[model samples]
Target: MASQPIKSDGGSSSYYLIPNGARDLLDLIEHKRMEFGIGNIFKACYRLGEKDGTSKRYDLNKIIFFAQRELARLPKDA
Candidate 1:
């Protein structure tokens, strides 16, 4: 919605901007009881496709990296 300003207050970044109806990253993290690369993936998604100093490409790259890490950490069938 771009209604809230970017506030870096303390631990939770609940004030970060997102689409009006979109699910918040904090909600996802809490619901998922996130462990390992999930948090980083959420972090990257939180700011993805925004004009926050870093471009959307940067966030995409971060998401890709975190996803790759998570995928790698999972058990693989032989």
Candidate 2:
């Protein structure tokens, strides 16, 4: 999805709102794990969204949900 530019606090920013937030966040988590390894999934996910300019639009509930789900999937030794 294309990001929308929004104005807030007298500033402008762009963000993409996931059509299916839960599924998109889960897919993003898995993709990051594969590409970046399991160092810090939550932070990685946040950073990825920031880099992609989509973090602001990601649903807070879905973020928490996928973060916990991804953390549980991490290897104990990782």
Candidate 3:
């Protein structure tokens, strides 16, 4: 399935995609990181897992790793 696009306040050009069931976790991490800082990504994941029962099954570290890797691949201008 095609990945879903994530909206960012930065601009239309600043966006990312989340594939599979990791969308919510990634979205929460991205939003929290932008609002708080990179240090909060793991905290956000833990909080989301506690609040959202379905998120517990996902491997937060793996998701963050892959997401960051994919985001890094985007053009610097993007």
Candidate number achieving the greatest TM-score relative to the actual structure: 1
**Tens-digit lDDT track for model 3 on 1-78?**
115666567855434544345555556465434433343455545575665554654547545765686578779997
What's model 2's TM-score?
0.28
Clashing pairs in 3: none
- lDDT tens digits, residue span 1-78, model 1: 124466675776754434355477766566546775778777877777774588889988888888888788878961
Candidate 2 backbone clash number: 0
Alpha carbon deviation, residue 48, candidate 1 (Å): 1.2
Relative to the unseen true structure, what is the C-alpha lDDT of residue 39 in candidate 2, on a scale of 0 to 100? Answer: 31
Q: Indicate the residue-level lDDT of 72 in model 3.
A: 80
lDDT of each: 0.70, 0.50, 0.54
TM-score of each: 0.55, 0.28, 0.28
Evaluated against the true structure, the overall lDDT of model 2 is: 0.50
Q: Candidate 1 versus the native: TM-score? A: 0.55
- The lDDT leader among the candidates is 1
